[model samples]
Target: MDAVRNPYTPGTGRKPSALVGRDEVLETWRVALERAERGKTDQPLVLYGLRGVGKTVLLTQLRHDAEKRDWWVVQVEAGADVGLRDLLGEGLYEPLSEIARQGLGRRALRALKTALSFKASYDAGGTWTFGVDLSGASGGGADSGVLRTDLKRIVKDVSLGAREEGVGLAILVDEAQDLSSDELTTLSMVAQAAAQDDWPVLFAVAGLPSLPQTLSEAKSYTERFHYSHIERLSHTDARAAFARPAQEEGAGWSDQALDYVVAESGRYPYFIQQFGQSSWDAAEGPVIEIADARVGVARGQNHLDSGFFRARWDRTTASEKRYLRAMCPGGDTGIGTGEVASRLGKNLNALGPTRAGLIHKGLAYAPDHGIIAFTVPGMESFIGRQPE
Candidate 1:
């Protein structure tokens, strides 16, 4: 089999040849888009999961769904170094530019002007006009220095402008757990305003398992927002995820091979694609067998060890690595911070900086008040394999 035909894409946010096990979430997003066009609003959607579980892929798909409906969509990845105001202002430029043409409706012009004000709020030097005349437009208060006030004004104007064109607006944020508390609070407030006033706008954010908790702490109203917990594929869906792509390319997987790969991959979408690709390459032809799967798993594990796992491992400082080692015998499950500090022969308060550093680096997260766990599945095994 030619490697070129391999349909398994194991990169970040890569859409699989067959996106299995997420039909419900996709359908819900689809319905939300349709309803928005009819002037109905739905709660913001929050997706939470461990790394490689396909939250980013699903968030990207939701963006695609809105795009297909001609909705004004802004998708961005939140980061600790970047503020939400700048990320959003930059994300909106392309969409606003796409519709900034002559003879634009008043609502569109107003939205464009408000967008200019939003941009000015963040970057006083850089500017964008979208090549439209807005001398008489009625939207410019977005320049206010307040995040909540400015964001609300721009979102309202832009969503209303989208409604004038018979569609809705969508804001999708990835890695949302990295956003600051203030940023998160402002977003929640704006989203609540949008929902209460029936603005044609929808927000979908994806992040680690702690995201729901983070949002709840940011604003209690987030309790009412739709939260979807994305996890590893079920056995049946895992089978389909592994088998469908190869089948489409005239390649089939023997039952033993499929079962071996599915189980060995732990049903995680990223691991499935990696093993599927490796297994396909190991196979001689039309059908992949158990032996091929064994070879594939071996090769896939090597790839993950060197690339996926090693990358995160390398990012940790020597001290951070030691801290990670202490958490390992616990392996993937949340471990009490007290125990980790005890294992290191230090007071719990002494390791506070180390624990916070790991969380900030995205390698670990606080699953509960005093519990810490790896954000990436199988990370414990990877750390165990490392030399002292």
Candidate 2:
């Protein structure tokens, strides 16, 4: 098999060749889009899961679906270095520019003016001119310096503009768990306003497993938002994820080989892709054999250890690494903070900073009160392989 023909894509947020086990979500989003166009607004869609489980990939697909329908879609990734206002304001420029023209709809002109205010809210020295005069348009209080007020203004006006085009607006955020409490609360409130007013706007956010809890803590009403917990594929779907791509390339996988890769990959899409790519390269040709699968799994594990897992591992500080080592005894499952502290010969309170540091670094999260677990699958095994 030619390496160039390998269809598996095993990188962060990379869309796999055959996206499987997510039809239910796709269909739900499709219906939501249609409903919005019909003036039936739905709650925001929330996707929470572990790393490498394809949440980002699925979020990207949702963006694509809205893009195909010509929705005013703006996708951003929340990070410590960027505020939600800056992210959304910057992401909106190109879409706003694309629809800007002379004699544009009043609602669009309004949105353009509101967008200018929003931009000024963050960057006072920079501005965007959609090549149109907005001297007569009415809409520009988005620079209020209040997140909720400003966000609602932009979303309301832009969604109205989209409605005039018989479409809707979409805002997709990745790593949503990183957003500050104020940012998250503003988003939830704006989304509620959009739904109540039937503003024809939809929002989708993707993040680690703690995201739902984070959202709920920010605003209790976020409980009403549509939630989907993405996880490993089913055994059947896992098999298809591997087989379908190979078949498309005029290659086939023996049943034994398929089982070997799927089980070894634990039905996780990223590992499946990494191992599948390795298997394709290791095989002699038209059909993948069990022996080739063994070699491929070995090679894939090496790649993961060196790149995927190692990169995250290297981000930890010396204290964080020790804390992570203490966590390995529980494997990938959550361990109580007390237990981890006990293992490290420290008081639970003394380990608070270390525990919080790992969570801050996105290497671990509190799945429940006082219970911490790796955000990445197979992280414990990776730690065990690491020399103390």
Candidate 3:
């Protein structure tokens, strides 16, 4: 089989040939966007899931869908190094500048310009020069270095300008769990202003399962945000997502073959694509048999360990890796921090920073008090291989 003809995409953040089991969420956001634009009701949407659950893919797809309706969409991400202010400055630069030049709300525009400037550098013509007509629209926006106090006015202004254009602003933030409390507050204030003024702006954030807890520490009003907890696909949806892409490429899957792929992949989208791709490549003819799926699953193990699992493992510190590997023996759900401490021969109290560090790295998360699990499934097996 030609590599170019492979229908399954196992690459990071790549959209699959078939997206299944998420129709409800897609439709839900659609209705919410429509209503928000009409000033009926609005709430920020947060999609929480473990790694490889396709939250990034969903966000990308949603942005595409919204853009088809002529909506203004901005995709930003908070990462290991990037802060929320810089991410906002980068993602919102164009939209803020575009809406400002139209002059819908003059004062708000000035305030937004100032706030963004604080996020950027003074040498860059006073923070984030939005080129074109905004070359001189730099000063008098938000006071320098005061992001929280000035955020509401800037957002109110931007959303108003967006409403005037008849298309709203959609901010998609990935890895939002990395955001600080103050950063989350800045976003909350924007959402509050939008609801009060009927401005058309909504945030769609995607991050780990711990994100809701992380956001709650900032404001109890997070209940105002629509929460979507992404889980594994159902048996039917997982099978369809497993088969449809290869079927479209003219490869047929036997009933047993499809079942094996689905079961072995545990309904995780990333693993399904990995196993499916390997199964397709392993088959001699157009139809994939059970033997091919078995071999594919075997071959796919190395692919997954070397690729997906390895990425997360490589990001861990030596001490963090020890903590995660110790976690493996406990089972898939999670391991007690006490057990982890015993394995590491360290005091539980001393291990607190290490546990927190792993969570920050996105390698693992705390599901409950004194318990933690890897953010990605099957990490136990991955840790066993080649002795990390």
| Top candidate, metric lDDT | 2
lDDT of 1 at 340: 93
TM-score of each: 0.98, 0.98, 0.90
lDDT of each: 0.92, 0.92, 0.78
RMSD of 3: 2.9
Q: Candidate 2: lDDT of 155?
A: 97
Candidate 2 off by > 4 Å: 101-103
lDDT of 1 by residue, 1-388 (tens): 6899988898788899999999999999999898889888998899999999999999999998899888999999998899999999999999999989535788988999999999999999998968767888889889889999999999999999999999989999999999988888888889889988999999999999989888989855787689999999999999999999998998899998998999999999999999999998998978999999999999999999999899989999999999999997884989999999999999999899998899999999888999999999999999888889
Q: What TM-score would you give candidate 3 relative to the actual structure? A: 0.90
Pairs of residues clashing in candidate 2: none
Per-residue alpha-carbon lDDT of model 2 for 310-362, expressed as tens digits?
Answer: 99999889999999999977848898888888888999998888888888888
RMSD of each: 1.0, 1.0, 2.9
**Candidate 3 lDDT, 207-305, residue by residue in tens:** 998888888879746878889998889999999997788778887889999989999999998999999889888888588899999998999888998
Compute the lDDT for candidate 3.
0.78
Error of 3 at 36 (Å): 1.7
Candidate with the larger lDDT of 1 and 2: 2
Inter-residue clash pairs, candidate 3: 110-141, 111-141, 114-141, 114-142
